[model samples]
Target chain A: MTALDTARPGISPTAAASEVEAQGRGGGGGPSRRKVGRVLTWLALTALAVLFIYPFVWLLSASFKPRGEVFDNRLLPKTFTFENYIAVWQEAPMALWLFNTLLVTVLATVAVTISSSMVAWGFAYFRFRGRKYLFGVVLATMMLPQAVTMIPVFLIWESVGMTGTLTPLWAGNLFGSAFYIFLLRQFFLGLPRELFDAAKIDGASNWQIFTRIALPLCKPALVVTAIFEFQAAWTDLMRPLIYLRDSDTFTVPRGLKSLVDQFGFGGEWHWEILITASVISTIPMIILFFVGQRYFVQGIATTGTKG
Target chain B: MAVAADTSVTDSPPGRPPRRSSARSRETRAALLFISPWLIGFAVFTAYPVIYTGYLSLTDYDVINDPSFVGMENFRALLEDPKVALALQNTFIFAVLSVPTQLIVSFFLAVLLNRAGRASGFFRTAFFLPKMTPPVAIGILLLLLFNGQNGLINEALGWFGIDGPDWTTDPVWVKPGLVMMSLWTIGASVVILLAALRNVPQELYDAARVDGAGWWRQTTHVTIPMISGALFFILIVDTIAAFQSFTEAYTAFFGSGNTTYSNDAALFYAIYLFQQAFEFLHMGYASAMAWILFAIVLVVTLIQVRVTKRFVYYEGEQR
Candidate 1:
């Protein structure tokens, strides 16, 4: 906590901070060490940020460079070209992978949006015999690690004859991830009771109430669920690896993995082509957030609180 | 007030009075309709597989041939499997090494990002983007960095007059390299923790400051306890995830190579199970390994929940 503590060279940053701040000497010698401390902290933070971001920069720059120059330590390539984009495009079925991800993601997003809200509405208003148990079951699934259930699910998907198609991919998430179900249920449970009561008093059907009142009021939760689904559908590697066999059905991640294999033993390393493919895979996601950026904060804010 | 209208009055024998509110029945039907997809899915995908895996854990089920009902033998073999012991030891080490470090780093980064006035979102996004960047891309990126002959990390270290170890080849450095890769995706955890920090009911902050508490005092006593719910949540999930570090390790070190390591370092539990299931085709033994992992997660998570009582703070929950 003082000069004595700083003498221990092995103290990590967390300990150092806790010590300095807790001891009230972090401000430093009025002005001189204070400046030094501030400068050092920012420098450290800047280095960490670069460590985090520089790879993507290298990725972009190397995607344009030749194989020989890929390992070169430079921020920008000596020359830039569209060769990577063209080669990757011509060599692989990037378009098909993009299409597969979009179809499954959109359909699954819609399914999750509707189903989660509906189920959440039921959990909120319904006083059924086993309602609590049902909600508990949905929540419990969130804690069940996907790795544990993965092989079993794989065997089942193969058994159903849905393997090597887009059906298994979307269907797995269409019923909704436990995250969305819990998120929607939390939001729905928070809604005012009188709205449902009024809709019913008007002789509205349960579907009508759900469609008109519940769904309309749940835009935030729906967007949040859709965001989660978009990310999952976009970035998933393992599911498509097993169920999908054909190049035509590959998602972006799986497609990237294929780029390595297609270039077999004799083929040259297409650093440019691979980076461009990786760059393209991230485009839809960036676009999703750019358009849905308003709801992005809302999405993360509401998840995992109740569940 | 939400009672279904007395439509039975006309259908029934001019019932003396309308049946008690049919709301409950309608609600039940609505509940059933709502969860139909999930219920069907649960029955088809989750429920069946969960039970089936449990059944598989007991038998020798290799997909290439019929599953023989060799009860307890698979599990017994699991105990004696040296790889199983090694993998279990490796998993605990990875978890112990990664979880606390990750939590500390992410929380601090979240704290720093939370303090930004104008560029907060930018910093937050910058910090969190790695979590979104495809892990496949990340694997490739790590491979690029860890390459012995020509890697940027080594070149950078060379500039400092120190020779960096061959990150991929060396057994001791391989897992640490994998753990480093895991930290890049701190965005989701940071975002969740940030939200919790934002939720720390500002009154507590004001009260702490009123008592002349500095930022450290305020954070330790007030901010952390208030966000203890989120911290506890991330701790449990992160620890469990650390126990299952696979794809990153699998890709970076063993893209196509077959080694238990020249020194046997990167053979993680999940990776070992992966080799058994897909590569070696020892499905029965792999199933047993998986069950062991499940048991590990269940027991650890249960222990976490139990141990969290002293630290986690739920503002509205009854004491």
Candidate 2:
């Protein structure tokens, strides 16, 4: 039941080897067949890699191209120009949006990390009446669809006159998210009980043990939590769309959405600016992913394998 | 002698007989203190919103006026609404198409990466990069790549001597186009399934081979069962996500407030709910739609759990 509770919508993979296996079997048998199989596998993988990476490559290339050559489908831009980037800055509030996104993302990420780790520490370290029930509730929240919560949560902020303000975006994260708490709790539980006992014997209070011992020891998990939350907040559009009515208050994704509206769909047809803004918004997250690649993989791997 | 000495010495201090209970209570207090943030958040953000939404579903709410009690009126309207049916149909089609495709593609990619061994690291990073792209950006890319005429996708298809449909403009092709776009972010799934694949002991494959199992047999019997738990987790998660998919579709079709595109084709349940709650100010109707979505998801998830229980192979668990 608890495992089911933690089932937030995510991604996964499949297995079927009929044609490939047949191909492997048909080849000049034994070692030659094995060699053929390996080559085929490499080919398939490389082809898929290109399919996956091409859009970003195209987007990047298009961003540097002039408006006419943007969709020329060539890997290299025929006429490379940074004019789109230059004009994007002048046309839209890109810098202000970036700042707003950074502020909200930082606040949300930091708040979720600290708060979730603290809650996780409680779940991991303590044995109390109703503890299981409390943890169950935490897990259960993950199962609640955002659609169910969105309107009422918006109304709550609206009632408080926090709508159209950046406060609504990060304020809820101060309470900690269920998924992070669960992830951090798993990390916390892996810590040996003896460490806390030793700290207690050394006259360190529970709070002292939590701050000084648990947190530092769980740095990798903390980094994972921070990275995940940072990405989530940075890319989050729904909350911003709901709460942020003004252009100045919009986050990067929200700003990008507006740019898509303006350039791609209805407004003016300066698509190069939209493409430029899209690339600009994507780079930070791409850099973050590279920097925290190890932790990110480990964290996602644990989520799948553990529960 | 040590056991006798320990029993004689007592665990507590000589003058502190009640210390154990006090210490237990103190620890409980400390635990509560630590988890208070989650508790506060749960009450306000989760618990309250859920209950309030339920209440709002029963009323006529327009955000400007007070929510008046109009018991089940919104739910009744939801039953009569043609758009509700259309939205649900769109969402269902999307989930049906995207979830299994995602699972299969990600699994296949994971298998490829798993076999790649040392070279897997670079490929895994390459594959996972797209998952890092912002949803809004993905939406923009979707419009650009799938742009019916003179689009990169159509141009690529032209090279293969196949004509492409007007993906953004045509109603029939819109959902399919969205599914194609969804495939770009299967990186997380691939990484997850790869982890699961790596966890499958080599002994199982060796044993299968010894028993005369071929590559296909080994994959189906040994490799798949070993990773069924992870696969099941992904299935449930992806299904729920597919149902709730908002950002990319919203950004692509509805974000611009453009009436040119076939918006009905992309009118997903969550998107309609958004339109109702925010755009149309039909807060009560949206709340009702939300509850219906919740109920539908709950039933679907429960069905999945029941159905997969027999098939999912949790290691060391007794049959």
Candidate 3:
């Protein structure tokens, strides 16, 4: 009997007898079945993988193909060119949009990651009256949909005269998100208490412990949070649309939106232009996912298990 | 014994450091430093607006003109405002219908991808790309997809001798049009739920099988509990996100001829709020609407938190 057979008391022997009746490892044994299973598994998987990945591949390839050949069903490009990409950059405020999106996402991610780590440390390690209740209050904000806050936030932004610029973009992150806070808190909680006691014995303050100890330990989870924050702020359409009025300041998603305004079929600004922009916009995120897929996978798996 | 007693005494000196006092002082300072941004943002952006809107709902305050207080008027006026009632009703209906479908579709898709194995990453990213795609871009793509004449969907329907509803123009189909569009993004939640599913201890499944438990029973007893936490989180978040729907509603269109397309069927709370705040410039009234939104979300969220605890089974905890 094989190792897997240990659990199946009655069936293992019966299955084994049936297996012996057929042949040896040629086709009867569990190992052979596993091999067949693996092959079939791989075949099925490869098909699914292709289906998932082909659309984006086609999209990117189409972006490079000539405008006349854009919708052609050919998987390979007959005439490849960078002209579409260049024209998208030259024709519209694509550069401005890229610059604005990068600045906003980068700054916002930095603010959120640092502040979330700091606040999360406070929640994780500190002991004070109403601390539990206050933490609960923090988690409470997460449950409220951002839509409900739209008018209220807009009114407040208008009153402060911070509505139009890139101010709202990164500024909101400085306040931190409940998810990020809870994320770091859980990671910190999972860590052994001895480390904190060791730091305390050395006469290190909470800030020292936070900066030198807890923060470093939670790097994996924090990196995931940073990536998430970056992606969120970068690709956001709703907030930028509501707040930004000026064309010069439009973020990438917002800029892409303006491309469709009253425009008809394939002109200089049609299929080729929009397709190229879409490919360009998704490149960074795709790259981000590939580079950190492991940590990203782990991050999603472990986050918010406690609360 | 003497040496052990000496070690015990030495473990903590009689005059131990005054960590309690220091920690208390440090906590106060740390809290102030750590919370400064949230304090500012909440006070300036959230708290102020929430309070101001509550106050504003009772008054006629135009930015260009002087303020006037009128109590219970906006609430009474809201009852009479068909638009407000319509928007609220539409928002709830849209959320109620869409959230469950999105959740089930995503979970099942995750199941498919998970079992599909080697192709999982490609499918995961594929599914997730649309979620990451700009809503404007999606709205544009979906616009093409839903077009009655040449659009892909109707064209497919035509082959079966079924002339699909004019999705853009028909009031009956307009909301469903948005719901279909919303599905493009469930890939995000799918990614999340998929990850959670991976953490379901394989040994538990193995144990169930040894006990002759089938797939469905195994899922119910073992797999469900392992990842129920993540499922709950996503459900609550999805509900909130669904209710907050906008942008898509606004982007949907037929032609200038129909204006609002058979009826104002596409209008939801956020769209209506946008119109009130920016288009119509009813600043005070919109602020009041914001407060009502806050209350509704708060109550809903609280009930969810209160109730979900009963249904969700953590790894080791008993029901």
Among these predictions, the greatest lDDT belongs to 2
Considering every candidate listed, which one attains the maximal TM-score? 2
Give per-residue lDDT, candidate 1, residue A87: 82
Roughly what TM-score does model 1 have, to 2 decimal places? 0.87
DockQ (C-alpha based) per candidate is 0.28, 0.42, 0.28
Better of 2 and 3 by lDDT: 2
Docking class for candidate 3: acceptable
Off by over 4 Å in 1: A1-47, A262-270, A304-307, B1-18, B201-215, B255-264
* Interface C-alpha root-mean-square deviation of candidate 2: 8.1
- Proportion of native contacts in model 3? 0.29
User: What is each predicted model's overall lDDT from 0 to 1?
Assistant: 0.72, 0.86, 0.70
The sequence of per-residue lDDT tens digits that candidate 3 reaches over residues A195-298 is 98998898886678888988889899889899888888887877887788888999987776666542422223266777787777777777877777666666
Per-residue lDDT of model 1, residues B89-184, tens digit only: 888888988888889998887776554323557667767667767777777677678766678888988999979988877877776776777788
Q: What DockQ results for candidate 3?
A: 0.28
lDDT of 3 by residue, B237-267 (tens): 7788777777666544421232323447777
Q: How do the candidates score on chain B by TM-score?
A: 0.88, 0.93, 0.86
Please state the Cα-based DockQ of model 2 relative to the true two-chain complex.
0.42
What is the Å distance of residue A146 in model 2 from its true position? 0.8
Error of 3 at A45 (Å): 6.1
Better of 1 and 2 by lDDT: 2
